[model samples]
Target: MTATAFTSPSLSGTEALLLDLEAERCDAMKRADFARLREILHPSLTHVHAKGQIDDYESYFRSGGTHVDYRQIDRSELKVQVLGNTALMTGRQLLVAVRKDGSGTVRIDSRVMQVWTEHEGRWRQLAFQTTPLAMSVT
Candidate 1:
């Protein structure tokens, strides 16, 4: 993986737009709005869960509401960078959710990475991955 610096001098207009879209995506996940998510995610999307499972676009959507149901997502230390028509984002996420198996609420802290590509005048998320922190949040 190529490492690029995420120095926040100031966010450009493009960066700000992408950042908002990312936030909106998080909201969609929390509410289990599958239609909204489908609009925002790319057809070739790939997501690597914090637990180490990888999901393609189809499987990712299937997991939601079946394995885990997101309730809230709080992002911090988020950084966004734009390269041509693609944007890269990285941040820490505190996600609160419940298992579909009715175990209980789970609070997870993780490092997240996402890639968005501009297509047909709209940005669609192409890739996402999360790495869990050593200790999960309560």
Candidate 2:
């Protein structure tokens, strides 16, 4: 998958950099590039799924290769706020993947919030949470 281009002129340098890293993270997940993911995610990372499951850095990385196969991860409407050494990012994410436990595929359309911080001279994702958008009544 091609990387999402960040062409908005209104974004600050930090915001642009953070969004670029976010895109890279999504690409890494789709490609199962755990090595690169390790560099971007913090040791204390907390990832909360839309289905209410939570995973830390280790479990999150481990699940990528063994428990779930990611097909696509798309993000849009991204906004980032920088506060001192920390950043808060919010966006919409569309994820499609399959479970290795014979449960077939899963797709999530949700609003995501992520926390990142400057650690050891590099920005690393510290936490992530998703809230599923309510389904429209037919």
Alpha-carbon lDDT of model 2: 0.83
Q: Compared with the true structure, what per-residue lDDT tens digits does model 2 show for residues 35-109?
A: 999999999999997768899989986665457778878788888999999999998888887776767887878
Tens digits of per-residue lDDT for model 1, 1-138? 101122244768777777777777888887788899898999899989877888898998787534778887888788887899998999988888888778777887889999999877899999998888843533
Clashing pairs in 1: none
After superposing candidate 2, which stretches have Cα over 4 Å from the reference? 1-4, 134-138
lDDT scores of the candidates, listed in order: 0.80, 0.83
TM-score of each: 0.85, 0.88
Q: Highest TM-score among the candidates is held by which one?
A: 2
Give the top-scoring candidate (lDDT).
2
